[model samples]
Target: MLWLSCVDETAPALPAAWLIATDAQPANLPERSALRRSLACKVLARQFGLPDAAVEIGHEPAGRPLILAPQGSGLHLSLATRSGLVAIALAPRPVGVDVEQVAPASEPPLAMLHPEERRWLASLPASARPETFAQLWSAKEAYVKALGIGFARAPESFAVRLDGAGRFVVDGARNGGPASGFVRLTKNGGHESMAAAFIVLDQA
Candidate 1:
């Protein structure tokens, strides 16, 4: 299951919801960075009924989410940000999440893209301008988050193209079957945040 939450940073210790309890704080960077990380782990540990001290939450060498299990259960999480809001995604399998503040790109970050990305982003209609590019950024971020490589893996190294059907195209690979899970994007704090999870469901 996936959940999205927005919390006022000033407010401390809000109640936990169904799947996970999130202590979200919309604070500035440097001040809220550690708080955001702590809150995410706290909420996740609370979800699994683990004590705060028992759960070890650290950062990967590449600055990815690091979770130490006390019960030997398998789970993966990813977190990313843009300006204010910090987003988190959790799943039994591997999962990735990212949040970006959407704005009028006086100059979009497209200049940071390679030839292939430039061509892909340019192919979209003007009507789909920022939204399409925002989707692409969020999707790639989530994919890298899933891989646990973080930014060590180039965003352009993989491609995420969204079609009219709301499906995803990755590295010229389309998910037309029931293989991988879907991505969820929503507007939060005037930013675009996305979450992707791959679930292995057992059928009867």
Candidate 2:
């Protein structure tokens, strides 16, 4: 299951594997760190039936967050923050989540995408390109993060494209195939809009 909440709202009881997005942006780095820790603790406590104080957040050398105290819980998580929104994904296997603010751009940097993705973008009407680009970019970001390599692999090395039925698919990487997740566009109040994607990978 997936949950979306504002920072001031309470998180619903989530499943063992879930994804969450919050409109919680602290003003500074320290506050953001605290917010992440707090949210992780709450989610872990409920999911594992442990006391909140027993939950600890740690980082891999490459900077992915991990459960430190209850080390054998077999849970995986990924996070992304952008434009005042924070997204967290937890799962039994590897999971990745990314959120990007949607903004108009007359000429998006198509070179950063795989050649096939660029062609797909070029085929769309000019007016629709910006939102489409945001969706594709968020999906790619989430996919790479799920692999735990981040940009260590070039963005151009793989493609996230729409199939004929309008579903997103990942292609061109070693593990490239049908992507097992979704990209969604969300409206935050009146003026702010965001695109977020959640991906679950079979292999770690």
**Candidate 2 per-residue C-alpha lDDT over 1-204 given as tens digits, one digit per residue, 9 for 90 to 100:** 555554333335332223345556567877766766787677667666778898888989987888888888777877666655667777777777887777775577999999988998999998888888888888899888888889898999988875433346677644645565677777643336777787777667
User: What are the runs in model 1 whose C-alpha is more than 4 Å off?
Assistant: 6-29, 51-54, 69-71, 114-117, 125-127, 164-167, 172-181, 190-204
Q: Please report the TM-score between candidate 1 and the true structure.
A: 0.67
Superposed by TM-score, candidate 2 places the C-alpha of residue 33 at a distance from the truth, in angstroms, of 4.3
Local distance difference test, each candidate: 0.52, 0.72
What would the per-residue lDDT of candidate 1 be over residues 1-204, giving only the tens digit for each residue? 434454322112212111222234446665556655665666666666766667666677876676776546565656555444556555565566665444544345786554576787688676555666666666666666666666677665555556544445456322333223344445444434333322222221
TM-score of each: 0.67, 0.81
Candidate 1 residue-wise lDDT at 117: 67
Which pairs clash in the backbone of model 1?
none
Which 10-residue window in model 1 sums to the lowest lDDT? 10-19
lDDT, residue 189, model 2: 34
